[model samples]
Target: DVAFLLLTFFILTTEFKQPDVEDIVTPSSISKSKLTEGDNTMTISVTKDGRYYFSPTNNPSQRVELLEKMGEKYNITFTEQEKTAFQNTQFVGVPVAQLKAFLQLPEDQRKKYKGSIPMDSANTQLVEWVQNNAKINREAKLAVKGDGGASYDKFKVLFEGLRDIEFYKFVLVTTEE
Candidate 1:
């Protein structure tokens, strides 16, 4: 009974970390540096298929707030349900213009939609997302996680998008080999 009581107490007091945004096979590196977890960090993930996902570490409220702000800027109004869905979403990869439609899909469908956010000169939604988030919180640290099998051109586009907004400093997320 004492062991059971102790286990229950510890479980109740411990904080659980959120799961990773997606299962990615990150490129390996020899660096031993560890990533610092905080509410002010933004992780941008690129999948093997060139899809992109943006997530602010440990801050669901901030994600929802960003969505709301973006909606207002684009003259798109999201329902409470949509806002809640955004909060629950681990990462956002859809364009702002299609966010409403994306949010309306079932969670499973949203997960299955393998579309990448456009980061070209003609379509600058990715740049706008980063710029808006930076405007809201200038101190937010940025990190890019690219899959080992992903193309370099995808990353170049992402870098160019950031450069357009004058954000030149960002970390690359990699695993120790």
Candidate 2:
């Protein structure tokens, strides 16, 4: 009787709340792979235009800024090492650090950091260029699914962007058929 009374009290007093969830759809792939579940893991989508969109694993509604955020967080645009890497290759894209610094600076402050009275419109264009191309389209775990038609070059850029953000384990979405 005593145990039953305690159990009743506990049950009555306890509060239960269901967590909110979002719907995320991933495309299937033929290759075998595993899903990574976590709060930090993110799913990034590489569009045909080379735009990237990503969301955290647990919360799909939370939109990620993708490259600009990464470039800001990792200081990729200002780092000397990234600059050196960019200079070494001709076809290589802009130095990650340069991009980061450009993105990090405020519109008005860019001129001060850039060391000139009149800001270079070209540099400003580059900053806008970075922000314009990246976007988060949907809510889902950063678990990425790609169509077979996804290009290798575009994929490489996506990979580099992921690497820039320090994500090593990615849940590659695929189908059995």
Which predicted model would earn the best TM-score?
1
Give the range where candidate 1 is weakest over 10 consecutive residues by summed lDDT: 55-64
Worst 10 residues of 2 by lDDT: 114-123
Q: Write the per-residue lDDT of candidate 1 for residues 18-112, one digit (tens) a residue.
A: 55556788898999988885778888888888878887544677777788888988999999999888877766788888899989899888876
Q: Per-prediction RMSD in angstroms?
A: 2.3, 15.0
Q: Which stretches of candidate 1 lie over 4 Å from their true place?
A: 1-17, 57-60
lDDT score, residue 113, model 1? 70
- Per-model TM-score versus the true fold: 0.85, 0.34
- Model 2 Cα shift for residue 24 (angstroms): 12
lDDT of 2: 0.40
